[model samples]
Target: MIQPDYIFECSWEVCNKVGGIYTVLSTKARTLQQQFPDHILFIGPDLGHAGQAAEFDEDTTLYADWRRTTAAAGLPVRIGRWRVPGAPLVMLVDYRQLFSHKNELFYEMWESFGVDSSQAYGDYDESCIFAAATGRVIESFYRFHHLESQRVVAHFDEWMLGFGLLHLRKYTPRIATLFTTHATTIGRSIAGNNKPLYGYMSGYNGDGMAAELHVEAKHSVEKKAAHFADCFTTVSEITAVECRQLLDKAPDVVTPNGFEPDFVPTPDRYPARRADARQRLLRAASALYGQTFDSDDTFLVSISGRYEYRNKGIDVFIDAMNRLRTSADLPRAVVAFVLIPAWVYAPRADLKATLEHGAPTTAPLPTPFLTHWLHRMDDDRVSNFILHAGFNTTDGERLKIVFVPCYLDGRDGIFDTPYYDLLIGMDATLYPSYYEPWGYTPLESVAFGIPTVTTDLAGFGRWAQTVVSGRDITEGVAVVHRTDDNYAAVVNESAGALLSLMRCSDAERSTIAAHCQSLAARAEWERFITYYYTAFNHALTAAARRADA
Candidate 1:
């Protein structure tokens, strides 16, 4: 078996996430380990969610403690292990404990370290503390892992791991570091389409200046990661182009994201399942959303992902829905709209948070590890929410709204849980992000034999557009653009596309689902993992020749 000395990938969102990095790593870790031969180690800020989990073996226990020394330096600390499927040397780094040390670290860095938390790391707030703490953690990892080096490759998923890449590169020249920015800070900030909302000045805290500077520092990290890492890549070619223009650093490779075929429950494998899924979901969603629909007035429309507003196209999609309902004179269809938007905050934003847990909120986590973050958490309440969708439907609305804007960390992922249950049942998906480095839902939807309607902006949509035989693409994976002057037209077209999909009888949608199944069979892990191997080999071989030179 071929193996690399080490594989390092970092995400600020780990089990306790604030963004998409968590989703990519957690979903791909199992296959990643097999491709690289069980040498992948997660570098992250655990926050508090990672305590002692059942996944840790004795040897990995040492690795857990090694990570803990820095992450929980100031707080009450414990160790946790990630239970990945194929990866043998998987380690989950928890950052919850960082909350306690933030203030002290910033104070010390200012007074003794001669570093102002505001200038680069943060300015007496989240930006400062988080960056500083994360930087320190990466610094420590090198000390711990550098001495026992073999052939190694480290990739930082986003800027959160920027400082660590530099720290390692200075001392361990042999270790190849690849930095991947799924989306650039400048790209997202500009795509935000509004300055004041996610502006450089406006921030999680009311302290405006720190937010502004944090934006700058984030851009700075992009340069550092791209310039410093041996090889760099983005999730899709579109994203790579964006990165190159934004950072003036062209990605060496464009590694597209691949979903697990069998896990997605595509249409072909489950020929008879679509009708059953739709019926089951209609009953559940009907009771969940509390709308009355006669037998004929039912349609299932869905859009799920973090709430990036302009980036994810939720508002445009909503407006499109309004048009679809208002413009045409059709029989009242039960359009069950299910929205799974991530990052549950942003009240002032047009796409304001909607949908209270109509059902009893599932009994909270054993002790609510997220007590502090609950208000800001775009957390997935799947267990309680699955039950929310479990109600009986005499008449289901054509639309079902499901909003999941946080980290679906556990087994309840869209691919893993009833989330797919909801997908298998929906007539169409609404994902119109302004800045999606890579969108996985469209791929998943197509796999379920349900065609998707996404935008060219996302990595998947951009790539799928180029694929010659999309008979392999899931049933309804249609790509839409958000740049149109008339979003209403965009919406109309998108909705019309979705309606066209529904126009197909149940069997036709299933046939489309079969095409998606064939598509997934080709998107196997066989070729995907080879890139990591190739990247590591390139880095190692390049480093070896450099030494001889």
Candidate 2:
């Protein structure tokens, strides 16, 4: 296998934790660091206040000489270490200085690579400016270090950073470029718009759909980057299919996302952590409902991700919980949590008071299901579903739904705990996604030794089906077969899967938990990082051939 002397990976989510991409990069950092040592660097946009954020610990002296040179060249950056497991070196580039040159950059891109920014709007301008800045940063570093003859790779993730790959290819043709689209822009738009994406994927035209969805600018950049990059890659086989159809390109490698075991508690501490998590979760639910819950008899489950009602299957998850509420075979009382963040106003004061003081001796608090108050409570889909569907957690109800519409970043008032802390409390997780390229939520759940129910439509779910034979919760993951037209079947299957988890005996549950951990171990970066090396070798060879030509 060929290896680059230095690897520079750029993403909009390097130190910024916006989405699953953050998880992908942060978890994989340690493995990359182990292989490359200090030779690997990450580049990201310098959101103004990033220096003060806990995720970034700045160090002005580590790269002082290069920083001075780059600053003089009109690229301002902060050298730091991302506070992930590996603590890898990071460079947060302030791209605001390039905004004034946006028009010129866009024109050059259009002339050189046919990237159309004519129909750009929303975040297009900002993202492209940042991307161009990253390209400049990489070039400046390469020149300052006199690395023209060394093997180097610049990897850009998602369409948001496509412009950087184009800029690098144009300015530094010798440096190999890799572009990975976690999900195609037009493909996600098609699914989000309630179109039958899977059913009509074969007949759909990428350009035509881009025009129809008003995503022409993003689609143009993404498609061009994929075509122009020395190596193109996506997260999973499912998304590779999307790329082949929607982006008109096939990935050189399918690099499935992986997790690090460092985040999980060690064996000696695991039991105590699990017990504490269960207690806190039960206490919070009991406080909200004005009823005590027996931790032994209550099954805690959750569905968390971006608040995409249809795409992330939040709607189906809610329906599945409703199905479980009335099922006679549900062996344990369920406290299902919807942990997706939304436009939240604040944590509910009454719930906080109850958590601080005690559960009221009287009736349950108003809006007993919500831990936080959303800004548009009247218009929120999850809130509306709970109310309209009569998800009343009465004195004797077997199922209760709690809507946690705030990011649990250890400061979300009520829980005052980070997402991972709360995630350990879940007995099972449901991610019945309709268009997930790779379902990280379910993967994260299983990594924490919690059985999960995911649909075959998700990339992770499809991968899980190949690893386990039965497709049951007993195997720690139940990959339910989901199609665009089978909403009802998906919900029923998901509910039944959860029921199966709840009904497991203590010995059976222990076996399932072991299976969960075993499955997660198979997906560690140690196993998955070879695909990345393959992609790197492909890019390097292609770039070498281009240089020869």
Candidate 3:
């Protein structure tokens, strides 16, 4: 039971909600805090803006003394607590002060660790500066406290912070380093570019692919950090294979992402919350299409996550909805919502007016398919797909697709409800991902007792197989097998799975929902957090070995 006396976790997403890594850290924070208490510290870049106030509640007095010491050491930090379920201790550092030293730092990284920053562009420089600044913060903290004998572990998440791990290795050798890549840059790039990743994964040289795809700098730092760290880890078994093939280093352990259901409403409050969500969803649909849908019979289905059209299976989801609409012997009215966030100009004024009026509409609202108007409707993939399919949200259509292009943070103008609030109202979710390292959306859906249809390509779908062991969609998780060429088959399977759920009796649906929640319990941090300890131990043990050597 080798334990870290202090755990310093750093990520670009800490308190900065950009993507899935934020959920991974924020959800797991409470469990880690319980074990380590105040010893667990999270570090993130403090982009000087007002938006951080919502997620980070700063407490200058909490670390006033140490913060002063860090300031004197040339590293100014905002000591605070992340405003999440755990409310863990967080230090958001202003790394912009180090921008002048960026070139010198990049030069040092290139000379010392062979990290090629010459080809870096876009956010590459900013991420590197932040990473180096984060490392300096840890170094200063260690020296200020004079805890050389402490078993300290500094964990870096994703390639964005890989340079920090290298920084720690060169300057603060006493701190055990662990680097976890949630997804490889080259792998995601290959998928995004419509290149076949899995088929040619064996022959693909990581460096070559990175150069060709113009992600050389990120891949360079990440690959080097993977080899240089005391412990290299990834989030899932599927990603481990990616690390081995792409990064050229097999992970020491797999730390699967876990969730906490603390936000789940109490048993007594469940029905009311669900009913409220259903009413809001129905109201929005009625306002858009001008026809009231039966709340009890209308099946609420959704697909939510980052707007990755092909990667997150948004394209396939639309295809399935199209298939369901055109098929015969349909069971119920299906209202599908594409809840993924996109670049929105503003909330549709007509939709807002309709929602506020609280009246069912029969005439279609202008641009009825989308809840919000986007800046570049011409370039929007989802909108283009819906239009290309020639499906409109007319009163005669059985299936309707509502594109919510804004974050549902209870103030998206249309829903006025947070994601979880709306998620609970869903009868089923479809996340037939083509390149999901670990599908958090589907996991969240199942956690809320909404049965989900996901492909085996997703890490969660693969892990669900072990939970029920040979049970099919009856277990509330329909795992569809998907390959590079199985696009049409996957769409058909997704549609068929939804049809099965619709055909299920009310009692059967309840049983399936119960089973969904049951499976979600197995994925809770209480059970899955043990793997994190494994990675921590590996990091500490490797550090001890290197120190002795």
All candidates' lDDT scores?
0.55, 0.90, 0.89
Q: What is the lDDT of residue 446 in candidate 3?
A: 85
* TM-score, model 1 to reference: 0.72
On a 0 to 100 scale, what is the lDDT of residue 266 in model 3?
79
lDDT of 3: 0.89
Worst 10 residues of 2 by lDDT: 47-56
- Using Cα atoms with residue i matched to residue i, what is each candidate's TM-score against the true structure? 0.72, 0.98, 0.98
Model 1 regions lying over 4 Å from their true place:
1-3, 49-81, 94-149, 194-214, 266-281, 288-297, 327-332, 342-418, 468-475, 481-486, 545-549
lDDT of 3 by residue, 501-535 (tens): 89989999999989988999999998998998888
**Alpha-carbon shift of residue 452 in model 1 (angstroms):** 0.3
Model 1, residue 204: C-alpha shift (Å): 26
- Sort by lDDT, top down from the best: 2, 3, 1
The model with the greater TM-score, 1 or 2, is 2
lDDT of 1 by residue, 1-549 (tens): 234666766655554444456546665777876655656776554343535234433253555656566544642223334544453443344344556765675455445423333445442244334444444554566566664456666677676666556545655666677777887776677667543322222223312322553565566555666776777877887767666666777887777766665456433656456666665444433333444434334667777776566677766666666555544543447353534434333222111111222342222222111111224333444323433333222232233343343333334322223456557766667676666888877777766656677777787777776663322223435666555244666677676776666566667866776666565555555556666666666666666676567
- lDDT of model 2, residue 107: 98
Candidate 2 residue runs with Cα over 4 Å from true position: 50-54, 359-361
Task: Show how many residue pairs clash in every candidate, following the order shown.
Answer: 68, 0, 2
